[model samples]
Target: MIADARRAVVRAGVAIGIGMGGFVDGILFHQILQIHNMLSARIPPDTLVGAKVNMVWDGVFHAFVWGVTALGVALLWRARGGSARVPGRMFGGALLLGWGSFNLIEGVIDHHLLALHHVVERLGPSVWDWVFLVSGVALAATGWMLTRQIDS
Candidate 1:
């Protein structure tokens, strides 16, 4: 029925929004910031011998992140019962907020304090990295708050 269709669309939109937030984190940090890639594994510089090995692992890691995000979206869709619910929204938001917070803290500790990587290496990386993290947290908090409103 038309109502069902509308519900389905709404649910899908919520899932997509959350998933897109995750995708943006991965893309901006892994690609644009160039601080780190999706994978935890590190790749040696291209000047190093066997650099190709690192490249291969990097590609695999990025693919894994993409797959995980897709799976998460699918799971959210199922859990929300074709409709966005308070619990689902809150939980998803919390999860993403945690992830962003972790990244922000870790990046500061490892890259800034530890000097493992420059804050801006060749270009300005830290600025956008923080922005991405903050945006993610905001989205998650909004989702959580929306979930609460629906619940009440």
Candidate 2:
């Protein structure tokens, strides 16, 4: 059985992962790539007005990501007492697990199910979407493996 402190740390790590993942998506994909936005599919960021509107939604998404990240920070702070006892690998694994989870669920919900946006919108549901999901699975699997490697 896992100790309460360890569990808390894991939770915190996952939260951090989620926030970081969201940031990556927002910064890399949404902003830098100019590929998609929070509502690119629905809004179709072809015009200045549409782009601006998507920008607003992106801001909202960032705000929510900030909140999740803050929660993770708070959780980590609470578990500081066990910092010495917990292994670094555990934390790292937790982060990957969280990040991959975010990608998997978000990819499925936003990219496939809702059609809110995709990894690359120009192609309109192309191989990039599958690649995103597969990457998520790979991340999550690696994380799980890392966690399993911890010495008992």
Candidate 3:
């Protein structure tokens, strides 16, 4: 049986991982690399207005990620009071799982289903999108294995 504290720690790690993943996507892909935006598919970022619109949406996405990260921080703080020990491996696995989950869900919804954006807007639904999804599944599987090992 898993301890309540362990569960709490895992949850917190996952949440923080998700938030961190989002920040990486936003900062690296959206801002630094200048690849794609939240609504780059529908609103091309060629003009000033289009760029501003995408920026606003990006801000919204960041805000949501921040909230998730804050929630994780609170959970971690709360779990610290518990007597049960949380293995470091468990926390690390949880983070990987969370990041992978984010990639899978976001890639499917934004890049495929809704067509909100792609990994590379210039490519227009190329192999890079598939690679993203595959990498996410790989990360999630590895994380799951690590967590299961620690749990057992």
For lDDT, the strongest prediction is 2
Q: Which runs in model 3 stand beyond 4 Å of their true positions? A: 82-85
lDDT of 1: 0.49
lDDT of 2 by residue, 101-143 (tens): 8899899999999999989988889899999999899888887
Across 4-92, the per-residue lDDT of candidate 1 in tens digits comes to 44344335444455445445644675567655532223333444543455446557755655665576567556655654442544454
Tell me the alpha-carbon RMSD of every candidate.
7.2, 1.8, 1.9
Score each candidate by Cα lDDT.
0.49, 0.88, 0.85
Q: Can you rank all candidates by TM-score, best first?
A: 2, 3, 1
In the predicted model 3, the residue pairs found to clash are: none
After aligning candidate 3 to the native by TM-score, how far in Å is the CA of 129 from where it should be? 0.9
Query: Where is model 1 poorest over a 10-residue stretch in terms of lDDT?
Result: 37-46
User: For candidate 2, what is the TM-score?
Assistant: 0.93
The reply for model 1, stretches above 4 Å from the true place, is: 1-22, 32-54, 80-119, 123-136
lDDT digits (tens) for residues 34-110 of candidate 3: 99999998899999999999999999999999998898888878776754556778888888887888889889999
**Alpha carbon lDDT of residue 101, candidate 2?**
86
